[model samples]
Target chain A: GAGVSQSPRYKVAKRGQDVALRCDPISGHVSLFWYQQALGQGPEFLTYFQNEAQLDKSGLPSDRFFAERPEGSVSTLKIQRTQQEDSAVYLCASSLVPVGRDGYTFGSGTRLTVV
Target chain B: SQQGEEDPQALSIQEGENATMNCSYKTSINNLQWYRQNSGRGLVHLILIRSNEREKHSGRLRVTLDTSKKSSSLLITASRAADTASYFCATVPGDAGNMLTFGGGTRLMVKP
Candidate 1:
């Protein structure tokens, strides 16, 4: 693809329902990252992946939140028993290298509403 | 947590004027980058400046980084109505693993 792509541009879920968001990063991008952005706030890091290895999970808010990039090309973020506070835009970004001096390309994001 | 803080939560300027936004971070950073986001849209990378470099320019954008003050600024020259968007600053911590920490953005509105 020409750019990073995310699925389900908008989602409405029940407070206790589970939801999954997907990201298809730019071809050959070696690093993938997930971020959550609240209304009127900047994106907060959720997790990071270097290829198929999950190098960092410290930013995941809870055990219920899980992300996997098994193939090192596409990734998915799953949130179980979603809460009202979880209502936010889930962003996906990819970098050609580790986010050092390079800028990341971002997806449109999945606006998840846990009502 | 967010490592950077951008000032002037909102800015309004005329189309032909220049707009500047400032950002400050709390940690040693390998580099600083800027991004823009229109309402309901994804972020678009603008520029990146390495810690060793004090300034960098790309087209109509000029970025300055002050490692001593742990601050960076983005200047958009000859702003246009189409340039209206939320501008953010993100840092790659020199000591931490590869993750970009973003700041609360500055919303700019350029009137035509």
Candidate 2:
């Protein structure tokens, strides 16, 4: 892949339905990040991964949000019991740095609409 | 919980006019980077200014940082209609890996 790729470019879920979003980062990139962007706001950091380790989940809004990077390559963000407020664009980004440097490449993002 | 807030939540400018957006953050940052997004799409990295640097430029884009005041500004000169988009500022807190906290962003509309 030339850049980070996100699956299900758009998702419409019933309020309370569970939804899963996927991300495929560039090959060998060691750092991955997930963010949520509301209609008029900037992307809010949700979680981050360094290889397979979830070092930071502090930004996950609530228990309904969960993200995982199982093989240090692909990642998934699952939201349980989706609410109207959960309707937003989910972005995935990847970077390569032993210490995670100054550059990041972002995916097109999945637009989720909770009905 | 918005750490970084950009002033002028929205702006409208003529196609050839320049646009400037300011961002203010609350905490000590290792670096501040600017990004641009169109509609609800993914953000495109614009430029990065480290805590130690005062200003940087890339083509028509000029970035100035005032870490003392926890603020930064992005200037786009000779702007085109295509340059009209939401601009954001993101901060990486104190050498933390790749995690970034972003600002609310400024939405700009350039009319022809």
Candidate 3:
């Protein structure tokens, strides 16, 4: 792909429902990251992956939140029992390297709404 | 937790004017980067400055980094209406890691 791609540009889920968001990063990108952004705020780090390895999951809000990049090319973020506070945009980004030397290319994001 | 804080929550300027946004961060950082986001869209990387570098420029954008003070600034020269967007600053910690912590961001509106 020419750029990072995300699925389900918009999602509406009832409280307690589960939702999954997908990200297809730019080809050959070695690093993938997930972020959550609330309205009027900057993106917050959720998780990070170096290829198929989940190096950092410290940012995940709870155990219910899970992310996996099985093939190191595409990734998914699944949230279980969504809460009202979960209403926000979920962003996916990828970096050619480790992001220290290069900035990330981001997806438009999936706006998840929990009512 | 957010590592950086952008000053001036909102800025309004006429098209042809220069717009500047400031960002301050806590703790040491390996690099600082700026991004632009149009309403309802993803962020686009603008520029990145390493801790060892004092300043960098790309096209109409100029970014300055002061590691001693833990601050950075983004200046847009001859802004256009199309330049209106929210600007954010993100930092990668000095420690080896890929996660980038972002600031609250500054919303810039360029009126034609």
Candidate 4:
């Protein structure tokens, strides 16, 4: 693909429903990142992946938030028992190399609404 | 826990006028990057200034960083209505490898 692609551009879930967001990074991108952006706020880092390894999950807000990059090419972010506060735009970004030297390419993101 | 804090949370300007936004951070950083978001969608990387570099320019965008003051500013020369968007400053912590912490952002409205 020309750029990172995300699925389910918008999702409306019940407060207790579970939702999954998918990301298809540019082919061969080594680093993948997930972020949560609240309305009127900047994106907050949620997790990071290097290939298939999940090196950092420190930013995940709670135990209910889980992210996986099984094949290292595609990734998924699943949130269980979604809450009103969890309603936000989830962004997926990928960098060709390590991120310090190169800026990331972000997907359009999935806007999740929990009511 | 955002590392950077952008000033003038919102700005309104006419096309052809320059727009300037400022950002301040708490801790040392390896580099600071600027991003633009349109309609609450994806963020587009604009420019990056390293800790040692004081200034960098890309097309109409000029970025300045002062490591000593832990601050950075972005200047857009001859802004256009298309430049209207939310601008955010993100920092790579000095010790962290690739993680970036972003500020709340400055919403710029360039009126035609």
lDDT of 4 by residue, A1-115 (tens): 9999998999999999999999999999999999999999999999999999999999999999999999999999999999999999999999998756668899999999999
Residues B26-86 of candidate 4: C-alpha lDDT, one tens digit per residue:
9988899999999957999999888889999999999999998899999999999999999
Write the residue-wise lDDT of candidate 2 on B1-112 in tens digits.
6779998899999988999999999988888999999886788999999989999999999999998899999999998999988999998887554578899999999998
Docking class of predicted structure 1: high
Residue ranges of candidate 2 with Cα displaced over 4 Å: A98-100, B95-98
Model 4 residue pairs with clashes: none
- The complex in candidate 1 yields a DockQ of 0.82
* Predicted structure with the largest lDDT when compared to the true one: 3
Question: Model 4: residues >4 Å from true position, as ranges?
Answer: none
CAPRI classification of candidate 2: medium
For model 1, residues B4-103, the per-residue Cα lDDT tens digits are 9998889999999999999999999988999999999999999999989999999999999999999999999999999999999999989866999999
What is the CAPRI rating of model 3's predicted complex?
high
lDDT of 4 at B1: 85
Candidate 1: pairs in clash: none
- Interface C-alpha root-mean-square deviation, candidates in order: 1.2, 1.9, 1.0, 1.3
- Assess each model's interface with DockQ, reporting 2 decimals per model: 0.82, 0.63, 0.84, 0.72
By the lDDT metric, which is better: model 2 or model 3?
3
